[model samples]
Target: MKTRFWLSHLRRVSPMIGLAMMVLAACAAPGREAPTTPPTPNPTLTVSGGGALQPSPVPPTAAFPAATPTLPPPPGGFGSPACENPYLPVRLGATWDYQLIHETTDTFTRSVIEVTADGFVDQDEFAAGAVRQGRWQCQDGNLIYLTPGPVAGSVFAGEMQTDVTLESNEGFYHPADLRPGQTWHQKTVFRGQSTLEGEIVVETRTEVNYACRAEDFETITVPAGTFDALRVTCEVHFTTSVAEGMTFEIEEQSTQWLARGVGMVKSVGQTEGAPPYTIELLSYRLP
Candidate 1:
C-alpha cells in the first residue's frame, strides 16, 4: 500500500520485532517514490519565473499563489535573540513542502530523499524530459538505490539536491563541509521552467555527527515539534594526492558550520587506524 506508506517505515527492521537491521532509516530521494514516469512538458529542473521550461501544456492559466500562513513565533527562540526561521522569506515563488537527504557510503545504498518545491523567479530553466505542467517542482517520489539516470545509465543520474542557481534558487546560506563535529553540509540544486532536455540532481547532506557533536544547539525532533538548529556556511576548494615524499600531505578539506538539527554525513575519523568514512544519516527534515 504505497510501499507500506514509508516515512522510512520508522526505519525498518520489524520482523515482528525479531530484530535484524542494525541501522537503516535512510529514506530520502523524495522518500523513494520513483517509477510511474509520464508527465513531460517544462521540467528541466523547475522554476517558473522567466528563464524558460514551464512552456507547453502548462497553461491552465498557471495559478499558484496562496501559501502565506506562518505564525509560530512567540517562543523566545523565533524572531530575535539569535533565532528566527519560520521558513522565512522563502515565499518568493510559491511551491512548498521540500525535502531532501543524501547519505553517501558510495553506490546509492539509500539516502536520496525528495518532496519538491518551486517558483522564486529571476530565472528558471530545466530542459529535461517527462514530467511537466506548471511544474515548479512535482517529483512524485524519487526514491533511491543510486543509478537513476546518467553515468552510463542514459543520462538521468539519480540524486537530487535542488537549488542550482541561475537566479533565485531555493533559500540561502552557502558554505558547507566538515564532518567530525561542528558539522555542516548543504547541497541544494534547482532549475526547471520546461520544453524538456534534462538535468536533475537532488542530494542533501547536513551533518552534525556523533552524540550530536557536543552541541551548539541542535534539536530537531519533529512530528511537528521541537526545532532548534544551526549550521549554514561553506567554502573549501581542494586537490589532494601527494604521496611522493610525504612529509605530511595528509589530505583534508575544512570550512564547516553545521550545527542545526544535523543529518546525512555519518563519518570522518581518519587517523588513528583510519577506517571511518561513515557518511550515513538516512532521514532529515525541518524545512
Candidate 2:
C-alpha cells in the first residue's frame, strides 16, 4: 500500500519538479513514524547546511531547523520579470504536453495549460483526475511561487484523509535570463496532516532547499522539435520532522534543459535512494 501510494503521488509531475517531489513522498510517513535508515548514507551529501548524517536509530529529540542558502543570491536579484524569461514564456492559453519515462518501461503524460498572470495550471488527466494550479508572483523581474498547486495525491482512499499546506517559501523559481555559470538558491517549508475517520492522526513538516547553477547552452531535440537549450544543474536537500521528535534527511540531484520560447524541454533526476527518471517535452503551443 505504501509503494502504490507513493508512486501515485510521484506521478504528479510539476513544471519545476525535482527533489521536492521526493521529499513529498517521504512526507507520507505518519507524524510519529521513525526513520528506517541513516539520514546520510554513502556519497556524502555536499548540500549546504546538510551537515553530517547521524547514526541510525534517530532519537526522538532530534531537531534540525531547515537550512538556508549559505551564499548570497547571484547578482541581479536571483530573478527577473516573469514575462522576461525567454526560456519560460508565460502566455495565456499556452499549453505544453510532456512525457515522463521511468527507468523501467513505465511512462506517463501530463500537461500545463491556461497560463495565468501569476502562474500556469498543471493537469494529469489520469493520475490527478482534476486540474491543479499554483500561484506565482513577478516583482521587478523576480518570479516566486506563492503557493504550489494543490497536490491531488493527498486524496487518500478509505477513511484516511491528508492535507498538505505550504508554511513558507523563499527564493525564485528561475532567473529572468540564463547566464552561463549563474547560480541561485531557494528554500520552502510544507506542513502535512493526516486524519483517520475524521480524527487527526499524524502531522509532518518538510523543508526543502535547492542550490542550482546554469551550465551551458546546446541544441537539443525532443518529440516536440529541436531548439537551443540551456543546461541547468541543481542539488536539493530535504529535512522532514515529526512531532514525535523524529527527523529524516535526504538529498537529490537533477538537471534540466530549457529552450528559448519553449520552456523546459527535458529533465533528468534521481533521488538519494531511487532510480533515475526522465521527463521530455512531447508537444507545446504558444499564443
Candidate 3:
C-alpha cells in the first residue's frame, strides 16, 4: 500500500454533446470548426486570507493522542515533550507494538510489528510476514543495527531501525515544505476516539503500487465524544508517495478531515498524473 498522490487529467469527461454543439456553432459562425486543440483545465483555487491552509496548525512533527489499545508511547519517569519521532520517546526498557498501514491505489495493507527495546543489545522484532523474529541494537540516535534472528541457528543481518532515519520526533509531512521561522498559530480543536483509527505513517518506498489519498478542508467542527484526546472534531491529513529511486513531487494541497474527536481522518495524496488513492487504518500499537 503506497500512500502517494497520483494526479491525472481527464482525457475525456464523458459526453461530447456540449463540445459538439460548440464545434457546430463555430462552423456556422465563421466557417471554422474551432481550432482543433483540446480544452485546457482551469482549476479553481482558493487561497487563505490569514495565509492559513488546511491541516491547520501543523508542526514539523505533529503529535496526536493515538490509541494505546496496544500502541503506547513511552512509560512513566521517561515522560517528556513529544519528540520528532514518537518511537524514541518510549521507555528504553519497554516492549511495544507498532502497526503500520501502507496504501496504494487498489489495495490497503496492515502490518503489526512488536518491538522490545531492552537497552539495545537484545532488541527484538516480531512481524506478521517475517519468517523469523528480527533483532536490532540501538546504537545511539543514528544507527540501528541487526544482530540476531528470531529463529534459532540463523545468521545476523544489519539495517536501520526502521528503514528510514525517522527520528522519533519527525513529522510525517516533509519538514522542508513548511514555512521556516514563521510564527504560526496552533491549537487542538477536538478530541475523541477516531472511528477511523489505525496506521498513520510508515517509512517504506516502492513503485508500481496502488495509492489512495484525501482531497480537501480548512477548519473542522468537532462534535462531543468520549475520547481521551485533548482535541475534538480534529482534522487528519495524510500523504503517500513511492520514492523507489525516482523523484516524485507534489505541491501542498489542503482538504477536510472529518472525525468526531479527530474530526476528519482523511488519507489523500497526489503524484504527477496518477490517480489518488485512500487507505484507511484499522488498528495500531505504539511504543
Candidate 4:
C-alpha cells in the first residue's frame, strides 16, 4: 500500500479537493460530516523546564518482552545512543540507496537517504529531486518522530504548494526492541492551506492514525545483498476535513523487511484504490 496516501489524490480528486488531498495524502473515498469535538491531548508530549517539547518516557509493556535477546550494536554502531532498534540504524554519515518501482506505471525512481545528527534526509533524485526530512528524538529508549506536522517523503509531495501547521503529534517511530507480534502507534493532527498552480484551492484539517506490528523473520534478497530480516507491517488511516464541507477517509497498508544492521531492505505498500508498489535496497554505505 502507499505509505503516504496522498500520491493517489491527483488522479481521483476534484480540482478543488485535489490539492487538499495531496497535502495530507487523504486521497481516498469521501466520508461523513466532519466531527465537531476537539481532539484529546497527546500523552507523549510534555513541557520541560525550559519550555521545550519533550517526549514522555514510555513505560515498558510487560506483555511483550523481546522474544530474543537484543542484539548488541556494532562498535560505533549506526544507531548508537539515540535509536535502539537493530533493524534501523540512525547515525551521522550513514546512507542508504533504494529503488521504488510502481508496478502499474512500470517506472522506477531512485531514493537516497543520509543520516544526520538529528534524524535523516530522503531525496528522490529521479523524481524531480523531491526531498523529505525527518527528526528523531528518543524517549525512554523509544525513537520518536519529533517533528509535529505532515510527514515528509510522501510520493505525492512536490505536486502542490502546501503550508501546514501541526496542532499536535504523539507516538514512537520505533521501539527500543522488536519482538514478533510487538506493536506501536502514532497520532498527529495538522491544519494547512493547499495551493495549486499558484492559486489557493482549499483549507484542510487532517488527522493521522498509524500503527505497526512485528510479524516474522525471513531471508530476503535485494540489489544490495541477502540477509535475515524482520518483517513488520503497518496500517495507516487518514481523516481529513476540507473547508468546502467535505471529509475524506483513507487507509493504507505497508510491509517492511529490516536487516539486523543494514536497516530496511525491502518494502511493499498499497493504498486504497491504488496499485501495489515495491521498494528495495539498491546499495548502502556506513561510517
lDDT of each: 0.21, 0.52, 0.23, 0.57
What is the C-alpha lDDT profile of model 4 across 155-247, one tens digit per residue?
433456555545556676677777777888877666656555655555676777778888888999998999788898988777777765568
Tens digits of per-residue lDDT for model 3, 1-287:
00111112212110111122222233334443222222232222223574311232233332223322242442333222221222232233433232222221122222223333321222323243222222222212221222110111111211211121111111122111111121111111110010101311112221111111222223332222222221112122222222111122222222323322121233343322334333232332333
Candidate 1: lDDT over CA atoms? 0.21
Please tell me which model should have the higher lDDT, number 1 or number 2.
Answer: 2
Q: Is candidate 1 or candidate 3 better by TM-score?
A: 3
Tell me, what's the RMSD of every candidate?
Answer: 20.6, 12.2, 19.9, 6.7
Shift in Å, residue 278, candidate 2:
0.7
Candidate 4 residue-wise lDDT at 122? 38
lDDT of 1 by residue, 1-287 (tens): 00111111121111111011110112113555322232232222343574332212321111122442232332222112111222222222322121212121232222112222422111111112212111122111111111011111011222222221221112122111212223322222222111112332111111111111212334544322344543322232111111121111112222112233232223232211123232223333332
**Sort order, TM-score high to low:** 4, 2, 3, 1
Q: Between candidates 2 and 4, which one is better according to lDDT? A: 4
Off by over 4 Å in 3: 1-79, 82-249, 252-265
| Superposed model 2: Cα runs more than 4 Å off | 1-83, 103-121, 124-133, 146-161
Model 1 misplaced stretches (Cα beyond 4 Å): 1-87, 92-117, 122-215, 218-229, 236-287
TM-score versus the correct structure, for each prediction: 0.17, 0.64, 0.23, 0.71
In candidate 1, how many Å is residue 65 off? 34
Query: Candidate 4 at residue 115, lDDT?
Result: 46
